[model samples]
Target chain A: MQPVLQWENVSFAYDGRFEINALSYVIEQGDFTLFFGPNGAGKTTLFKLAVGLLKPAIGRVVLGERPLSEWKTLEIAKYVAYLEQEAQYIFPFTVEEIVLMGRFPHTASQFWDRKEDLEVVAWAMEITGILRFAKRSIFQLSSGERRKVEIARALCQKPKILLLDEPTNFLDVRQQVELFETLERLNREERITIGVISHQLSLAKNFVKSAIFIQGGSVGSAGPPEAMLTPEKMSEFFGLNVSKVSVL
Target chain B: MNIMNASNSNVIARSPEGTTKQSQIQRLLRPQLGSRLAMTTGISPGKLVLIIVFFVAILFVTFLVSLLSGAAHVEWGTSEGQFILMQLRLPRTLLAFLVGMALSLAGAVFQALLRNPLADPHLLGVSAGGALGVVVGSGFLIAGSFVLAIPVLSLLGSLAAVMVVYRFSLRKGALSLYTLLLIGVVMNSLFISVIVLVQSLVRSDELTTVLFWLLGNLSFASYPRLFAISVIIFTAAWFLLRQARKLNILSFGESTAHSLGVPIERTKKIIFLVASLLTGIAVSMSGMIGFVGLIVPHLARLLFGSDYRKLLPTSAVLGGIVLILSDSLARVIVIPQELPVGVVTAFLGAPFFIYLLKRQEAKRVI
Candidate 1:
C-alpha cells in the first residue's frame, strides 16, 4: 500500500521550546498505527502537525504525495479527518445534527444538507451505533455515548485517513475496547488509514498493527507492535520499571 | 455490515437495509413538526412562512395602534388627525421598529459570535462608543440644532470601538474570545466614563437634550432619516442571513470549526463588522436604547430553535414588535409627559434577564 500520510524531517516548537524535533514517520493506506509516550512527549502535537493545525518549522508534511501547504483547509479536511481530545459544543445540537456537520467539507457552500449527505450521515450513525439516540441532545448523553457521536461525526467525513487524539481518554475499559474494535473494523473493511494517540498500551496492543513510541519530542522506535512495545522499550521510553507499568 | 456484526451486541435485529427501511417508515409515521424542511434550513419553509406572516400582521396592528393611541387620539379621516398620524406618530413608530430590528439582529449575531448567551450589542462597547460619540460630537456643534452630525459622529465612534476591540482581541492570526470579552468590558467602562465627562462639560440649556437623547428617544426620526437607515439595516440583515451556516458551525468553537474546514478567522471578522454596523447604526439613529438587543434574541431562541437561519430573522421581527410596543407604551403610559422608551425597555428587560439567569442556574443542577 502507498503511504497515505508522510511526515518528512518534520519539526515544531511552541513558545521557543521544541515540541517535536526532526521527526519522520509514514502511515500507509489502511494501516492501524498507535502512538504512545509519557505525557508531554508531543504525541498530540504530532497529530496537530499531521493535520496542518500547526505547520512544521522544518521539512514537510505530505498527504497523497502532495505537500500539505498546497491544499486548502477544506481539501485537507476531506482527505484527512482529525478528532481532537475533547468534544465541546455550546448549543444543544442533536446527535444527528452534530454528525450531519461532518458532511460540511462536502456541503460547505450549500445552504442545507443534500439527500446523499443525509444517507451518508445515516450510514455513519448506524456504524457508530448511535442511530438509536439520533434525535437526542448531545448534552444529554453519557460520556461514552458522546464519544460515539464524535466517532460518527468523523466517519461522516468519509476520509481516507483518520487521526484520533485519545479517543478512549475518558472511557471505561470495555468502552475503550469497543471503540478500538470499531476502529479496527473501519481500518479493515473500509480500508481507511488510522492513527491514534493513546495511553492504553496493553489494551491498544490487541488492535493496532504497528506502534510508534515517542520520547522527548522524537520517535524512539517504530515497528510491529510485538517488537516495538516490548518491556525493554516501554521502560526506556516511559522511564518506569516494567513491573510498575500496570496499564501495560 | 461486518463492523455491525462484530461490535453491535444488542438484540435488535438489524442490517444496513433494515435500518434504512425503519427510518423511512419512521419518517412517514412521525408527525411533521416542520423538521423535514428543518433538516436543511434549520426551520421548515412552511413554518418560517407562517411565522413571518403572523409577525408581519402583528407588526402592522402594533403600528396602527401606536399611530392612533399615543397621548392624542387622531381620527383617520380628519386632516388634523391625518397630520398627527402621518407627521408625528408614523415616523416615530417606524423608527422604533427599525431600531428594534437592528438591535435584535445585532444581539443575535453577537451571542453566536461570542458563543455566550449573555452577549449583546451593548455589552461589547459599541452602544457606549456611539453614546460617547453623540455626546462629544454634539458638543462641537450648535447644541440642539445638529441633526445629521449626530448620526455621522456616532457611527464613526462605534466603528472605532469595533476596530479597537477587534484589534486588541486578536492573537497572532486568530481571535481569542476570552480576551475579546474582557477587552469589551474594559472598553465599555472606559468609554462610559468619557461620555459622563463630556456630559459634565455641556451647557445647562443643552444638558436636558443630551440627557433625553442619552436615555433614548425616537421623536427625532423623520422620513428621510428612516429611509436612509432602512437601506443599511436591510442590507446588513440580508448579509447575516447568508452567513447562517457558518454561524452554526462556529457555535462548535473555533478549533472544531477549523477542523471542519471553516475559515473561522475570516467568518468572525465579517460577522463582527456586519453586526457592529447594525449596532452602530441603531445607536446613531436612536440614542442608546438598552435591553431590546439583550432580551429579544433570547425570547426568539426560546420560541424558535437556536439555528442561526431561523434565529436571525425571528429575532429581527420579534425585536421590531417589542420596540414598537414599548415605544407605544412610553407614549401613552403617563400621557402628555413622555418617558424615554429606553426606560420602558430596561424596566421590562431587567426582570426578564434575572428570570433567564435563574432558569439557567436551575438547568445547571441537571
Candidate 2:
C-alpha cells in the first residue's frame, strides 16, 4: 500500500521573518512515529501541515497519494485525526457529546448520533477507559481525564492515522504510563498509524518505532528511535548535556 | 489465594478514597433532574405556553383598558370603543410585541456572536444609528414628517452603523468579538453625540418629537407601521433561526468551528447582517428599549441551557410576551398620561437580569 502520509520538501512560516525550511518525511501505514524537538522546532507546524490545517509554503504534503490542499477537509478528516497541543472545549458538551463530534464528518446532519455512532463512541470510550465518565461534562473532568476523552474522540473517527501533539503533557506518572500503553495497544492490535510530537525523549524512546528530531525549524536527525536518539544528537539538537540516568 | 487476599485487604483499607471516588462517579452519572426536566419538559415549554397565554390575556385586557380608561371613557360594547380598539390600542400592542421580539432576538444573537454577556441591541450602536436616522429624517429631511421618516431613516441608520462596526471589527477575514464590542461602544457614543448635536440645532417644536422618539413611545405606531415592523422582524427571525446550528458551532470559537467545516466568513457575514437588520427595524419603530434584548436571551439560556435551537425561538416568544406586558403596564400604571414602553421594560428587565447574574455567579461558585 502507498504510504499513508508524505511530506516532500515542505516549508512553512508564521511570517516572512521566521520560516520553516524545506523538510521531507514520510509516515507509512501502521508506523508508530515520534517527532521530538526543542522549543520553536516546527513540530506543531509539521502536524498542522499533515492535517491540511496549514498549507506548505514550498513543495507538498500528500495524504493517500492526494495533495493536502486537494483533499476536501471532511474527506481528509476521515483518514486522519489530529489532536492539537491545546484542546479547548468552550461549551458544556458532555464527554459522550464531544466524542460524538468525531463522527460528524461521516454521519448525516439530522442523524447526529445514531445507534451506529453511539456504538463506535462507546467502543472508543471503552478502549480509552473513559466510559465511566462518558456522561460527565468535559469541563468537569481533570486535564488528564479530558485528554483521554479527547483521545477517545479521535479514536471514534476510526482514522487510518492519529496525529497527537504533546499527549503526555500534564499527565501524572501512572496516567502517562496508561496513555502510552493504550497507544501501544491501539498501534499493535488495531494496526493504526500514530504520529506524536513530544519533548520527552525517554517517553518517546519507549513508544515510537521511528523517530525524527527537529531543531531550529529544520530536521536534525530522522531514523529508527535507537539510532536517532543518541547522546550526540540530543546534545546538539537540544543544547543540553546528555547523561543517562538509571531508572530503578 | 494469599495474594488475592492481600490485595483485597489493601482495597478494603482504601475504602474511604474509593467511596469518595464512587460518590463522585455517582454524582456525575446521576442525571441532573433540573436540567433534564428543563431539557425534556421544563421551563421552556411551560414558559412558552405561559408566555403565549399571558401575552394574549394581557393584550386583551390592555386593549380594553386602553379604549375604556382613556380620557373619553369609551364603552367596550360601542362603535367608538371598537374603532379605538382596532385603530389605536391594537396597533400599539402589536408594535410593542414586534419591537420586543426584534430587540431581544438581536440582543441574543449579538451576545452569542460576540461571546459577551453584556451585549444588547442598543449597546452595539445599531440603536444609536436608528436614533440618528430618525433625528435626521424628522429634523432636516422631512421636517416633522415622523411617519415617513421613521422606517426609512431607521433602516438606513442601522444599516450604516452595522457596516461601520463590521468593517472596523474585521481583521484578516476574522472578527474579534472584543474588538467588535469595543468598536460598537465607541460608535454608539459617537452616534449619540451626533443626535444630541442635531437636537441642539433643531427648533424647540421639533425637540418634543425628538424626545418622544428617543424615549421610545409606541403611541404613534399605527396599523401600517405595525405591519411594516411585523414583516421585517418575521423575515429577520426566519433567517436567524435557519442559521441556529451555525451559531451553536460558533459558540465553540472560530478556529474550532472552521475545522468542523463551518464556512466561518460566510456564517459571520450572514449573522451580522441579519442581526443588524433586526436591531435596526426594532430600534426604528420603538426607539432604544434597553434591557429586554440584553436580558431575555440570558434568561432563556439559564432556563433552557445554551442550545440555540431552543434558546433562540424561546427568546423570541418570551421577548414578545415580556414587551407586551411591559407595554400594558406602561399604559395602565398612571391613568390618563402614559409612560414610554422603554421605561417599563428597563424597570422590569433590569432587576430580573441582576437576579439571573447573581444566580449564575452562585452556580459558578458552587
Candidate 3:
C-alpha cells in the first residue's frame, strides 16, 4: 500500500533562517507514529509541513501519492485533520459549535450544517467524552476538557490521517492513556493514520507502532520504539544520561 | 486504574440535562436561560428566525416611539401628524435603523476578522477615511443631501485607507493585530489632519454640513437618499451573513482556520472590503457614529455568543433597537433643539467600552 504521507530531503526556513535542514520521513497508511524530541526540535514545524500549512524550501511532501502543494486546501483538509497544542478564543462559543467547525470542509452548502454534519459532530463529541458539555461555554471548560473538545473537532473532520501536537498537555494520567487508546482504536477500526508530537514517552510508547527521534531539525532515527529508543541512543541524542525500564 | 477509567467514563456519559429549545419568553422569565440556551445547540434555523422576528418587533416599537416623541408634538390621528410622521420622523427613523444595521454588522465582521474586541471601523481608520472622502466630496452636496456621490467616493476612500493600514501592518503578508491597530490610529490622525486642512480651504457654508456629519447623527436623513443607502446596506449585510461560517472559523485564529481549509488571505480581504464598504455607506448616511460599531457587536456576542450566523443578525437587530432608542432620547432630551444621536450613543457607549477594556485586562492578569 502507498504511504499516506512521504517527505524527501525536506528543508524549511523561518525568516530566511533554516530551522529544518535535510529531513525526511514517511507515514504509512493506518500507522500510529510518534514524533519524539526535546523542545525546539522542530516537531511542530514538521507537522505543519506535513499538513501543507507550511511549504518545504528544498523538497516536497506527498500526501496520498500527490504532492501536498498540488492539492487544494479544502481537499487536503478532508484527508488530514490537525489539532493545535493550545487553543485560544476571543469569543464565547459553545463546545458544540466548536466541534461543528470540524465539518467545515464537509459543508454541503453556504452557511448550512447538514443533518449528517450534526450527527458526525455529536458522535465525535460523544466519543471524546464531551457530549454532555456540548451546551456549555467553551470558556467554562477546564483545560483538559478543552483539549478533548479540540480532539473531538479533529475527529469530526473524519480525516484519513490525524496530526496532533502536544495533545496530552492538559490531560490527566488516565485521560492520557484513554486518548492514546482511542487513537489506537481509530487506527485499527477506521484505518485512520495518526501522528502525534508528544513529551510523555512513557505513556505513548506502547500505543505508537513507530517512533522518530528528531534532533537538530533532522531525523536522528526512525523505527519501532524498542529498536530506535534504546537508552544509549536516547542519552546520546538528548545529551543526558538515560535509562529504560519495563513498567508492565 | 481500569476501574477508575470506567468511573470517569461513566461520569462523562451523563446526558445533557434539563436544557433544550428554550423559548424567548421563557428566557426572559428565567434569566439564567440566556446563558444556558445561548451555549447549547448554538442556534437552530427556526430559532434564528424567531430571534429575527423578536428584534423586528422591538424595532417596530422603537420606530413608533421615535415618530411620536420628536420636537413637535403632532397627533397621529390628524393629516398634519401623518405628514410629520411621513415627512420627518419616518425617514429619520428608517435611516437610523439602516445605519445602525450597517455599522453594527460591520463591527461584528471587523471584530471577527481582526480577532480583537476593540476593532471598529471608526477606531480602525475606515470611518475617518469615509469622513475624509465626504469632505473631499462636500463640493457635490445638493442642499444637504449626498444623493449617492458621497457614498461611492466614501466607499473607495474607506477601502483605500484600510488597505493602506492593513498593508503597513503586514509582517510577511499577514496582519499583526497590534501593528494593524497602531497604523490604524496613525492613519486616522493623518486623515483627520487632511480633512481639517481641506476644510480650511472650503467655503464656510459647506463647512457647517461637514462639521455636523463628522459628529454623526440621523438629523440629515432624506427619503430617497435613505432608500438608496438601504439597498446597499442590506445587500452587503446579506453577503456577510452568508459568509458566517467562514467568519466563525476565522475568529478562532488564522492558522487554525487555515488548517480547516479556510483560504485565510482571501477571506480576510473579502471581510476587509465588505466591512469597509458597509462603514463607508453608514458614514455617508449618518456620519461617524463612534460607539455603535465598537459596542453593538460586543453586545451581540455577550447576549447571543459568537456564532456569526446568529451574532450577525442579532447585532443588526439590537443595534437598530439601541440606535432608535438613542435617537429618540436625542430628540426628546433637549426638547425643541435635538442633540445629535452620536452624542447620546457615545455617552452610553464609552463607559461600556471602558468596562470591556478593564475586563480584558483582568482576563490577561488571570
Any runs in candidate 3 off by more than 4 Å, and if so which?
A: A170-175, A243-248, B1-12, B15-43, B75-79, B136-153, B169-179, B193-205, B352-366
Model 2: per-residue Cα lDDT over B1-366, one tens digit each:
444443443333334423566546433432331122123221234555765675567556654544444444667779987887778777876787788788888888887687666778788798898888877767565444656667688889888899899999988777767788899999999999998898778766556776776787777778777777788789888878767656765666665455554556777778977888888888777778889998888877766556565677778877876787777778778877788888888888888888877875665511
lDDT of 3 by residue, B1-366 (tens): 444443443343464323433222222323232223233454467777888787778777888898887789798689998888998888888888888989999888888887887688677788888888878777766754654465666777787787788789878776676687788889999999999898888766666767876787787778888878889888998999888999999888877898888888777877877888888788877788878988998878767777998889899888888888889999899888878889999999999878876774565521
Best by TM-score: 1
> In model 2, which regions exceed 4 Å deviation?
A87-93, A107-138, A152-158, A167-192, A229-232, A244-248, B1-74, B172-179, B200-203
The DockQ-derived docking category for candidate 1 is acceptable
lDDT by residue for model 1 (A135-237), tens: 7777688778888898888887889999999989888888998899889989997888999999888889989999998887899889999987778877777
Residue B192, model 3: lDDT of: 94
| Model 1 interface DockQ | 0.41
Report the candidate with higher TM-score, 1 versus 3.
1
Q: What is the lDDT for B322 in model 2?
A: 76
Candidates in order, TM-scores: namely 0.90, 0.80, 0.87
Indicate the worst ten consecutive residues by lDDT in candidate 2 chain A: A107-116
Ordered list by DockQ, greatest first: 1, 3, 2
Worst 10 residues of 1 chain A by lDDT: A111-120
Given the true complex, what DockQ would model 2 score? Answer: 0.17
**Model 1 TM-score on a 0 to 1 scale:** 0.90
